[model samples]
Target: MRNVVLGFLGTQLDMGKRRRWRPSISLCQTEGFHVDRFELLYDRKFSRLAHDVRREIERVSPDTEVLLVQMDLDDPWDLQEVYAKLFDFAKDYGFDEDRERYHIHLTTGTHVAQICWFLLSESRHIPAALIQTGPPRGDEEIGTFDLIDLDLGRYDALQQRFDQQTREYGDLLKGGIETRNPAYNALIDRIEQVASISDAPILLMGESGTGKSELAQRIYELKLQRRRVKGRLVQVNCATLRGGGAIATLFGQRRSHTGQPGTERSGLLREADGGVLFLDEIDELGMEEQALLLHALETGRYYPLGSDSEVTSRFQVIAGASRDLATLVAEDRFRLDLLSRLNLWTFRLPALRDRTEDLEANLRFELARAEKILGTRVGFNADAADAWLRFARAPDTPWPGNFRDFGGAILRLCTLAPRGRITRAQVDEEVETLRRRWRMAENDPDARLVGEVTDLTLDPFDVPQLAHVIRICRTAPTISEAGRRLFAASRETRTSRNDADRLRKYLARFDLTWASLHDDT
Candidate 1:
């Protein structure tokens, strides 16, 4: 195969006395080196010098052919111009890897040109290895040459840089919170990879306050930073989109019969074109809305309310659902087709209570955020901090509202701190307040359900647990479905996982049955 070397002419370096050997000349005349052809790029102003160098190359290496190509540059230092010209050259070049070996002469070009050459070669725009030539060491005219292959995997420094960048992106997605949970970190890593590469619909499923909306926004921001999206992110809560105006609110309305003809509305979907549409609580959307959404997702075309014409929108969807969308689909509440389309990249974010280990880190982050919000610094005393951390990490701490509840607690503490310091008394007060709130919540639902179903005085602890189970039973279509949801995490480890059997036994202890719970509900 013929060996081809391509480079820019180093006008000053190649124009010394005839005896002096330069980078381009030395590369061709090096001992034991064979250049079948040399493609030299030069400005039109250096046409005479380019001819002189080509003649010298042919004279020394009689078997080699030198092709002089003109690439006029008004300013060699302009990186944009240099890169664009070189990119165009590479794009137009007919490279046949099977017939010839190509090398990019990196030593002769300007620093900007050298950088552009590196980028082009690294990106495989120019399928070539980079070759650098330097002046001879002792008495040799043929100088020294080093070949550099742009394989990132082979370079530890480059690999580390890429790894660091990936870590930074993950941190950004997490709002700079130094989350230490292994499962959560792994989840973020997967999310980062998907957000960077895929434009498909992503569904984020988690309980309320579990950061679904935050993560969706982060995904949009990441895509924007990576230049994947050019339009703004349009966020809307599907739960609020109800009744007569839901369709118009989402798909927009055409001009009224009595209004101007050209004043047709563009809608949220149109506004989200070339960007992301975050539909929080997506399961709450009506059947008609779901059908329209599915159509838009599949075809990128939808009609405005009262309009005959169909408008187009090219957008990606990031859906957030607190409820089990699969269950909703099973119950015939949500459209199966819409769910299927959104489920391609579904991720379930673990609730705060499920990841208690990360509570301390999240608490500190919330504290920092609160300080910024209140424009005042606040810190817990040594004993107070320990007490709060202990209570926050306790297994029984419901944290039902997740980070939302956690952040609110932090803000309250900061606001009530005396002399910008939270003492044990303040911590005790806050803890009591949280306990009362949780107790009230338990009594409100549990007491009412238990009171209506049967007249039984139950232990305080059992009331909340049994109330939760009964609530799930009331909503789920079958005992098995309710059991599956309640024991989702624990069932994974059991050898013989019969959720229905387990749920039945637990309910039997309370002298209750799924049938009895649903009878009143």
Candidate 2:
């Protein structure tokens, strides 16, 4: 009897998929049996990719044991995202949840597998050795083979490689962020504090464009570098945590005591054991999860889904939210207890409006960053910078979107700019675009005024609209009567002021006031 190897090929399995899996030469000498059918599952879209892979797997290997090789193209280097997707697929397909039967490989290529494996196993202390015999001296064997149980020194060498690779990636990210960006500096201070001191849960409050994640990453890196924290910094966006398995994902669940049952996958908190768990959009966490989180924070203990055994992991928690948690607590949307626990050291990121002083610096920094990212030299001229400053300082301008908004505006200006330097006109145009979207633009002083301008253009008005309204008001019996008559035409136009102060201001701008008419007499 020949051992039949059933493989369900995913993304990299496609004919065009670039990898070292050259079946023609590699599998040529398999004597007893041949690959019965090679199902090709490939798609550019991710949702379709998973479905296609699953469908083809079922089609090709309906009964025989299948080895799944899943390709997660979303973030090719992100092992966590890839593993989560694979775990979900296994559960959705009712794969036995026990242990040790299925081999699920995530590979971009033969060489990439080792790289991915290195990254994935960096934090874990799994006892294993990978000894690779390079290509034969001659053409006897073209590739490499791995031998298990390497000497202690060799295993340590592999670990050192993992450390080196991890450091290289860190340096790359750090180099990208080393700048005088004021926002970056403020974020650096917060990250430093969070890393150095583990006394309280740090709450980082900022709008969406403020690079909350970057700050978190910096904090994690700095902490690891300074030897303040030992474990990995596990980040989880609460908005993405949804449905029944969310708790299971937060807390590890034991393996089903049957064939090939999936083993317990460590939750982020567990993974971050001695480090910081950065929770982005912490306000969006479900009520139940919030309560569970509160319990953990209070007692410093949590029960993983399948096990009654309480797992104790201590680490600093850094929670980021777009809104103030106090309001959420007031609305009963968030638990006061959790809010209290997380209120240790709260840092609210200044909105772009609040940090207007730093606008010029930020624009220059963002422009350079954008240029680097786009692989082009995009610059701002003196006139363009002046225009942007004027717009940023305009009374009608409200950057509700913050730094992100400015970045987008600059990018648009770059696109509209003739050569490379963005112009004042482009800045104004983008400002108007922002104004319209955010309703921050001052309302055009009434279309009726425009109509009056047109009419005045043809035949000059004997008196301005303000003068006409005052004339109507003067003839009225009382002040109330005057208001009723003057505002009657507004019913059809729906022109009204939400605030009396605004109305007063609008009237003041026209140099017309009740006192002006009274004094005119």
Candidate 3:
């Protein structure tokens, strides 16, 4: 398998244009790095330089192919835009070649570009080794280069100390939720380390259904199994913890004298003493609660409601938020100090849509759970399994709800399956039900309107194209306008035509019209 090299074309003119050009890419080829293909990202203005560099590499090493990628990016000096462009490039380029390994050339780009590459590799955003190339200092050598894996715990001399400790815990975390993504795998290992050694707060930031709560509880379990924490795990959804009772619920309260003789209650903080307290949706905490919580987290002291003396509760905190806490802090809704404390070991869980590669494994895991729950063994027929997996993993299936959606879907199938056996026909029927359900749940007025007018009797195969057409009809101001855009390419030679009537008649196939689609949902 040949290696694919990704790099940037540097603009530094240390070597004059007329001088004997010694490009890093050319040196890389000459040094026999075996870069079967080079994907160089550069600006439009650097076309000539990039072309010359490519030509030089091809001239020096005939087997190496140099391909230039044009980027529509903002200031090259701006790290934000540079990082965004690089990030977008990584997302857009499909790295589907199994035999070809990727290696990032960090020596031939701007400082910002090099930094972005290093960060991306470090975080496993780019699953590649960092290649540092430089001009040879000695007279006897070609350009000097070295390959470094971002995971120092994997290949470094200190592997025995840092890497070996978390190896078992890494496996444990993947017991239920299986993932093959390098970023997520590395994240599990990192989570194991923080959950094992440090008692400092750990924050899991990601969208809902990305398994934040599950991961939080898993962290506690890992700690408990290792005898790191001898107490029970206390979990709370802060979103549901609002109102006057928020303070009493979180910090406990003594018996009330003024009210109807309320009994003393142990709040979540006290219950979480000597253990891990996982707070999901931590951003929902109001400012007053935020202040009190910050004080308790910082000093381990909080006066329970209706108490004069301050009580102490020593507990490890782990917080999860679907929204960005920094933005909340900036908006003065959340405490900056609390944000600072929790930001120490933050990990972002990727959404299910982003981890579609793990669909098969996760789907099987969900089926196993359904079996345990229903106390009956269930299995999907070959055709049924294939059909369901295809729909679930399709690009258009925006898994806004993530894993929870998968669980619900599996439960529906398992509940309806006869003799614990799911057939292709059942899969097809359930798929249509889900499609109509999704259409009904649409929040957008135009999409909802389109869905209302859409004929569900149409063949399932026609839904994709029809759905797009309905959306176009709802958005276009006039029937003629919609038809013109739809027939733009085909009607290029014939500018004047009755495209409106054609489109109107086309919609009649589904018992619809342009006017009906534009109605509010």
Candidate 4:
């Protein structure tokens, strides 16, 4: 396959005719490189010079295809702005179909333009190596050309160093997070990657019981070990921060007027000045509190109530929310600017229900913790473990409370453990408690109907089949209608049969009636 080169048309071509021979063409010929094509990205102001560049290139290498690409970077002097535009262009360009290997010529164009190309190539925005052309000076008057690998990320030693650092960071943060789920592990890896280096406000968003607070503490610990923060970890549930003294409590009170300032009473933020300040359930903060919090974060200094002097916290903020701040922002409840600040390193922890695959491991983890605390180890009996997991992770059970409920169930089972072992009997009671709690919490009509199935005790094994029948019964106008729909697929194979009677018999086995279900719904 042939190699293609992409680069900009240097404005140096604007010089006198005899003084300029396109360096890109000379570099290829001098270095004995046979490029199949050349893609020249140029500004409209350089169209005439670009044409000259193309003609000069083909004059030397007639077989080389020259493609003129017009770019709209009016002024390339602003490196940041030009880099952004070039980066966007590179992303939008289709690099996937490049069957032929390619090189980005870095010799032509202004130094800023060359750096832009280098940045693009370095980040793999373009799937090619970098080509640099040096002017001829010695015996080799044709100068020299060098092809540089753009895979700087894959530099053996550099990547290995990064890998080792990541592993160390992962171990530090992975202390209690024992799980084998890929997505969850990936989330952990990402958290480790960001938490170690970023001093920016970190926002953790998730439903209740997803371990946001736990993760926040872990992050604090990691940073503390690294000496990123020197003070203690100060945690406060934003929901609990209320009453008229909320400001005083969070920011401390200044001494009364008259005499010199009294002893400085440091608030939570000041206490966490050199460490991490964790605000859990931040969505619950009142607008006034939010304003104060935002001001402190934005300025790194907050005023104590009744004090004119601004106290410096220098605290790293880690905010947790159970609600979507974006939605709150749209509703004008949350400050958009504050959200933007915290969103710099935002990570959404997955809900427990979404991570059902890790249920068994996490359950065992809680049990182990219980054993450590109570000094009595307990293992779930095979049947009990199976039964407990089934009931807890069932789709019918709305784990709206997530890991909080799961942990509580573990605690209950440990307390109920007999002979250091959880028996099937204990699991049965715990499962029922969870089911009842979920039933009460849910307001869905279907769940409400299921809760009305008072006479029947549906175990884990019986849930799937029984739940379907219950749904069909609630939705169908009559038992006959329910039966036909319930067995719609199977009934097609039945030459002759009463679906209503079949469904009736099925419901009778479970001690449920169609009339009872429909009326309940």
Which candidate achieves the best TM-score against the true structure? 1
Tens digits of per-residue lDDT for model 4, 1-521 = 78888887777743434334457667557545788888888889879878887888788788889999998786777798778888887878777544788788887777787788877777778778888776655566565677787464658878899798777777666555467778878888988867777788889998876888788888998787767788888887665455555676688876662244663456788888788999888887888988898889988898887688888878898999989999999999998888888898888888787888888778878988888878998898899999988887788776766777677678778877988899999988877776774665374444433443533445655655777777666544456777878888897788866999998788888767765553221
Over 99-122, each residue of candidate 2 has an lDDT whose tens digit, in order, gives 212221222233444454444334
Models 1 onward score TM values of 0.65, 0.47, 0.54, 0.55
Those runs of model 1 whose alpha carbons end farther than 4 Å from true positions after fitting are 1-26, 29-58, 61-129, 132-147, 150-154, 257-264, 443-521
Please write out the lDDT profile of model 3 over residues 1-521, one tens digit for every residue.
Answer: 88888887776631334233355554555454677888878888778877877877787678888788988566877899999888888887777557888889887667888899888877777878888766646563556678777665665767666566567678777775667878888889888877887888999999866888778878988989777888888887675455556688789888862354665778989999899888878887778888899889999999998888999998999898989999988898888888987899999999888888889999899899999989898999998999999998898887655776677678778877999899999888877876765665475443433344442345545655677776666545457777887887888677568889879888888778765554211
lDDT of each: 0.84, 0.57, 0.77, 0.76
Residue 184 lDDT (model 4): 79
Q: Can you give the lDDT of residue 304 in candidate 3?
A: 90
lDDT of 2: 0.57
Models ranked on lDDT: 1, 3, 4, 2
Model 4 per-residue lDDT at 270 = 81
Candidate 1 TM-score, true structure as reference: 0.65
Per-candidate clashes come to 0, 4, 0, 0
After TM-score superposition, the amount by which residue 62's alpha carbon in candidate 2 deviates from its true location, in angstroms, is 99
What's every prediction's RMSD, in angstroms? 14.9, 22.3, 26.8, 20.9
Q: Which of candidates 2 and 3 is the stronger one according to lDDT? A: 3
> How much lDDT does candidate 4 score?
0.76
Candidate scoring better on TM-score of 2 and 3:
3
Worst 10 residues of 3 by lDDT: 13-22
